[model samples]
Target: MTTENKGIVQRALAGLIETGDVNTLASFLSDDFLHHRSDATTSTKAEWLAAVHAALGPTAGMQVEILHLLADTDHVVVHSRRRLPDAGPEIVVVDVLRVADGLIAEVWEIIEPVAQTAVNAAWWEPARL
Candidate 1:
């Protein structure tokens, strides 16, 4: 079930990136899906879809590179890097999705802009014990 849930999220994200079709993305969501943003705002399925379309439509030229996927029985967390069309600094986005009955029922997302300065250890380096 955990693996299945992860796959469901992976496929949904891939579909959105590949086709840029809101309907395709909609197919993976539950009818009563809700999206909770980092800003403390929540959006319904329809509202989220509309937002996605307006922000990341085909011509937006946004690219998403998934960095990590972690899942349990009913939740999947995806950490990714997003590059917008303007070629500005990359953004890191983490979405935690709750899956029920093979569809995504809810999502909580956080987004942060990549820092230009060296603040800490390199992201690619393995943690030291």
Candidate 2:
């Protein structure tokens, strides 16, 4: 069975950034899912997929390194680092998700550019534990 926790979101996001496979990613999101990013002015899933595809079109690969994950009655928080094959690595994003019926329905995100105060680590490290 598919896991119904934040891992599902992370895996979906990973597939999007790494492979630009919006179809695979879309299956994991609710029809009303909210999407946010570092530079987003809108939150539509189509826009989100478009942006991911645009970025991956030039970059060779992408990766999301989740730093933290917190869950409650209806939500999950994922702090992550997004890396590009050409740009190297750094801590980049923190995402908050509201889930319903095992699907992500809402999201709020914070994106930080590479900074001295941030630390880069494995995505599955603390986020899974």
User: Over the stretch 1-129, how does candidate 1's per-residue lDDT look in tens digits?
Assistant: 999999999899888988788788899999999999988999999999999987677877788889999999999999989887887678889999999999999999988888742443355566632
TM-score of each: 0.86, 0.66
Off by over 4 Å in 1: 116-129
Report the alpha-carbon TM-score of model 1 versus the true structure.
0.86
lDDT per residue as tens, model 2, 75-115: 78878777767766554677788778877777787776686
Off by over 4 Å in 2: 1-3, 14-20, 37-40, 56-60, 88-91, 116-129
* Global local distance difference test of model 2: 0.69
Clashes of each: 0, 1
